[model samples]
Target: MATTNTTTPRPGGRSARVQAAVHQAASDLMALRGRAALTVPLIAARAGVTPSTIYRRWGELSDLLADVAVERMRPDSEPADTGSVAGDLIAWAEQYRDEMSSEVGVGMMLDVLSSRNGVSVEGRLPVPCQCAAFTASQIRTIVERGVERGEPVPVIDTVMDTVVSPIIFRSLFGSAPITSAHTQTLVAACMKTARLLAPVEL
Candidate 1:
């Protein structure tokens, strides 16, 4: 008689711990050393896991880097809608900058870009698969709110190009402070343009 294999796996066990540790190590190394310098031995040494374990599980440098990138992302999609488009926009922009400015955050983008050459790191990249659905939901919520408020909503790509990308570039690459004043100015400019492009009610 042939029997089908039935095994229910439980998460949050030792394997989970090892994954987390290794992931954190990868982020740390990318941030401190530089993404181009990463290697399996280096990650294993930092993570305290055997190099073979990493090799067996990830198989390739790009795979592990991509996995760590996703793990480092915010668990929630966008922040809560603040009931107003400007309010929501500013809040989201500030939060996005703050997150990216952190040491780990800086490295996150580097690893992402380094791993995928020829892909524009210009504020447009594939959303990590795990968070893709959640991020979509968040954008929908923000857009729906704009519609209700009778506000002129810029396309999501526009926001990324104008608001998100600039701030992230400043935080990650530039020397200037990503201060509140700087981000506020950005928000104001985008909001003004959005209003200008919006249709006037008769």
Candidate 2:
């Protein structure tokens, strides 16, 4: 299951400020007191909002934590451009593996997944795997660059299944290390699949 966005409407003015404060409180509490110590009332007290505000906006503590994780994991910049499709894929894959396998990364992933079956806050759109959306967006950028350079690029699903999915699976479930070598191996497999998919001249 992909991580989905349970993005609510981003109202401006006081509402945005309140939302930011609430998210910050949740993040701080998670870091300071840990997940086992958190509750909606505790977060609301820290954020200077009533518990009702939180219930009205996020529905559950898990959903709020997921929202925070999604925001924290959002890419701050475009993927590194390494001048070739293979270089780009390897660089991106290696970094992806490193980040997702880290302690912070694992926490974020679990937070997002914990909310998978939870209810959306009132007036919020149901999350449709925002976590995978983030991954897909980056892959699309890389594929577009490959196309502009006349390089054969695997379709998004191919890249997701061949490269990203394995990395995620190993990071979350497998006890095996997700090494740089392993990432490059996955990228190589994805590129091989792309080559097979490319049309050949008669």
Top lDDT: which candidate number?
2
Worst 10 residues of 1 by lDDT: 1-10
Show the colliding residue pairs in model 1: none
How does model 1 score by TM-score? 0.63
Candidate 1 has an lDDT of 0.66
For residues 109-202, write the lDDT of model 2, one tens digit per residue. Answer: 8887777444365543354466777787777777777877778778878888989888889889999748888888889888886642333320
Candidate 1: misplaced stretches above 4 Å?
1-50, 60-63, 116-140, 195-202
lDDT string, candidate 1, 125-192, tens digits: 55543333333345445555786678877665566667766877787779964888788888877777
lDDT value, residue 106 of candidate 1: 69
CA lDDT of each candidate? 0.66, 0.78
Alpha-carbon RMSD of each model: 9.6, 5.2
